[model samples]
Target chain A: MKLLRNLVLAAVAVGGISAAYAAGAASFPHNLVSGIDAAGWDLSVRKADYDDDEHEGYRRFGGGHERHHEDDDDDQGRNYGQNGPGPAGSTTPPDNGLILKGTAPKVQVN
Target chain B: MKSFLAVLAVTTALSAVTPAIAGEVTLTTNLRNYGGPGAYLAYYVTDASGKYLGSLWMSGGKARYYEHLTGWYRATGGNLGEIAGITGASVGSGRTLEVTLDLADALFDAGYELHIDAAVEDYRDSPNEIVVPLTSDGSGQPVQGSRYIADFTYTR
Candidate 1:
């Protein structure tokens, strides 16, 4: 009987630890990279302006090399108001500071 | 009996694992017609004693320009990780930026304050432009900024 009770207590403790870990992970999603279309922020009108064929980079003349058209700079690869610190290949992000990191906020720009 | 102790342990564990209660807060920032390039804004929180807590959001994604947000830069040393995955494009002149996030209930009515640092290209930088205490009484009340930002408000 004592052994059974010990096993039960151990199971309960493990379950509690697992539950806490899951809740903590759900609260802070470090990998969530939402776009301008996230909740409460809709920039679809701005993003739609760059969804044309010219904005897309593809293989020219069915060759192996992919090339962007000379006039493709207008959209800047359609990354306006999107994720990350800045445009691709701009610069590496700075180091982390001592300030505590918090949850990410959903944004809307009008 | 052993059964009673086991029950008590279960109850204690459950309560200990409970997460802090939180609520959604909506932050609105309206910019004045500064007539310059897009403005970079940093929205962060600090305690009553002026200790940096964390960042809510960062407008403008360029790390090089983050130093222009003087207040935040001084607090976090232009830490990109402080706003990683929480930044977006800069807000243009006369435009508005609205953000919503789930904040811990303890932050409100606990002597904490929300701050914004505004900067514009070729224009003067405004650090600590708007400093409003995060209290129930301050909610829904619009506060004017010193420079680029015209008005700022928070709603729970």
Candidate 2:
């Protein structure tokens, strides 16, 4: 029957163009983290309200928000490594190298 | 036999380091709204036979909502390089996320276990929710979180 109605109209036009390209790549909206990161008490409040390459601060401070840091490196927050940490699993070495057992997390929440 | 191969390479480098003592480990979470979207959450660590040991934290950083964090993407199958640099963000809905990390004292009283898997977007993915049990008399007590996690705690 017309090749199953042209394969159901090409699977509904490829699922409506992949849901409109995932809603145009998260066009940004619907975010509502709420006052003081939902009141647990600011653990640097998304690094003082977003930076380090936003897009939700590159998934909570892995890096990228056009690199600018330094109010003594956001007062030694975000990348918390005392002096450029991150080197061992959890995304090792430079940005996104999340440094775990090596330590870093003086207090971070968002 | 060369002194039993140099005492089996110094007992395999002292049984791969387990002298431990470290400290600090706060971790606190609270979320509930079940509205939809923004929730990832991972936090893993297991032993007493549960196995899968690794990943400390990883609050949603996208990556397509990590398959609704289904038991930490089936215990790290969704790798993302084991949550690079630890990760953060995405914890809204009645919120609360304390975090503190450093942890070690042999992951507390030994027989470790600390989990949390959550996931939301279209809702319903909850995974392990929260397991807790790194007892030294349960560290600093506080627990409860089965669906959208209303509360959970751990301390030292």
Candidate 3:
């Protein structure tokens, strides 16, 4: 009867220890997952504003370069030469009338 | 009786040392010169069947831009909690980002994969930029990325 009691007690102690170890191992993965999740979210928010601005700039400038105009005063003079060499024909249409249109370049992970 | 005692001592020592033997692993990703401002990179893990396990690291720091990481966002539903503590600075073009942490031993030799989703401002969002299998044989092997990432490597 004493031997039976000793075996039962030993079994319970081993079982208890094993259970604790298993629990700890299981929680390790969850803790790691949670920790990484928080860090990624925080990083994402920090760069959001910069990303938005970049997107806007790409849409406006095409590829980060601005279109240049020679001179406002010489605009009419240049057009005059192209349109029959007269003020009447030159003044009919504007020389700098070029329309730029296109959606912003798509942002992608690379 | 002496043999039984020896067996118990060995079992105790093995159990105590097993956790300590599960050392840490570091992952390094280097981006290419894509000519963009900064690249937002998401490092995540997936199970054998391609099910999302969890995020490992996030390079860019922005909440709104998380949606641009379409693959991660779709799998995690833009869950911010998945990468909170593991967040860091955005990686510039031609720059490298490294993350080191103690990973469970079981994760290796198990059918798992590490995936990266990269996005830059005004550029097309590239999901699954790099996908590498997790295996004992794959350690220290540098794999090239498809779009933005130049290469990725893992070391113990």
For each predicted model, how many residue pairs clash, with residues at least 3 apart or on different chains?
Answer: 0, 10, 40
Q: DockQ of candidates 1 onward, in order?
A: 0.09, 0.07, 0.01
After aligning candidate 1 to the native by TM-score, how far in Å is the CA of A43 from where it should be?
A: 49
User: For every model shown, what is its TM-score relative to the native structure?
Assistant: 0.57, 0.27, 0.54
User: In candidate 3, what are the lDDT values of residues A13-110, reduced to their tens digit?
Assistant: 99987898788853446677678887874424443354544434223121232223232121111222221112211122111111011111111222
Q: Worst lDDT window (10 residues) for model 3 chain B?
A: B80-89
Two-way lDDT contest, 1 vs 2, winner: 1
Query: How far does residue A15 in candidate 2 sit from its true spot (Å)?
Result: 48
Which scores greater on DockQ, model 1 or model 3? 1
For model 2, fnat equals: 0.17
Ordered by lDDT, highest first, the candidates read: 1, 3, 2
CAPRI level of candidate 2: incorrect
Encode model 2's per-residue lDDT on B34-76: one tens digit a residue.
6654566788887878877777777755554465576777777
Model 1, chain B: what is the TM-score? Answer: 0.87
Candidate 1 lDDT score at position B21? 70
